[model samples]
Target: MMQENMAGAHLIWMLILALVVVIPFWRICQKAGYPGILGLLSIVPIANIALIYFLAFARWPAHKSVQQDPSS
Candidate 1:
């Protein structure tokens, strides 16, 4: 029926939207030096939700530069 088709279409669209939103955040988490596995954490219960919020806002530590200061 037309209603069934429309529901299927809506489901697909929602899935696409979810991927669009999650992929970039995954990339961002990696860019911020978090483990790639963190992306999979998204499937977990409440923890996953919390992790995403943490990743989106937390300022992770930067990679330390190796060059030594001559003055020290």
Candidate 2:
């Protein structure tokens, strides 16, 4: 049926959109020294917001220029 074909097309477009959005986030997480899989957390409502806060506050391992004092 034409409706079924349209539904399939819509689903495919949505999946493509999700991939387009998620891939960059995944790469950003990886660059930030967090697991790329964490980007998938964006699919969750509350957790995604939490993830943003976590990434904002957490120390990134990739940024080696900022050395920490061990004596503290």
Candidate 3:
């Protein structure tokens, strides 16, 4: 019984930690003009590294559409 309770507590703590890490990563992806769903890739070991490299080098969609008028 005690072992089961300890395992349950460990699982809960792990879930909380995952959420703490994933939520901000999701927001960061959104702010960078990527889909928030992409943040879930961070949960994967190798894919998370790829995602970081892609984010760093890729052009942001939000910034790609800005127009400057010379007449203004």
Candidate 4:
């Protein structure tokens, strides 16, 4: 009984942690002009590393548009 409770708590903690990571990523992806769904990658083990690298180095569509503006 105690083990089951502990396992359930662990699962809830994991879910909470995933949400903590995902929500900010979702907002960031939207602000970057990328699909918000890309934030789901944050919950994946290997993909999270790839996501960070991509976000760090890849050109953001929003930035591109802003840079292309003649008014800027």
Predicted model with the maximum TM-score: 4
Considering only N, C-alpha and C atoms within 3 Å, which residue pairs clash in candidate 3? none
Ranking of all candidate structures by their TM-score, best first: 4, 3, 2, 1
lDDT of 1 by residue, 1-72 (tens): 999999999999978876776677677677777876676556557877898788768766433222333554
Question: Per-residue lDDT tens digits of candidate 2, residues 5-70?
Answer: 999999999889878877887988999887999988776789879988988888887764345545
| Better candidate number, 2 or 4, judged by TM-score | 4
TM-score of each: 0.58, 0.76, 0.82, 0.90
Error of 1 at 28 (Å): 0.5
Better model by TM-score: candidate 1 vs candidate 3: 3
Show how many residue pairs clash in every candidate, following the order shown: 0, 0, 0, 0
Q: Top model by lDDT, which number?
A: 4
* Candidate 2 or 1, higher TM-score: 2
* Stronger candidate by lDDT (1 vs 4): 4
lDDT of 4 by residue, 1-72 (tens): 999999999999999999999999999999999999999999999999999999999999999999999996
Q: Tell me the whole-model lDDT of each prediction, alpha carbons only.
A: 0.71, 0.83, 0.85, 0.96
What is the lDDT, from 0 to 100, of the residue 5 in candidate 4? 100
Candidate 4 CA-lDDT value: 0.96
- In model 3, the runs with Cα more than 4 Å from the true position are 67-72
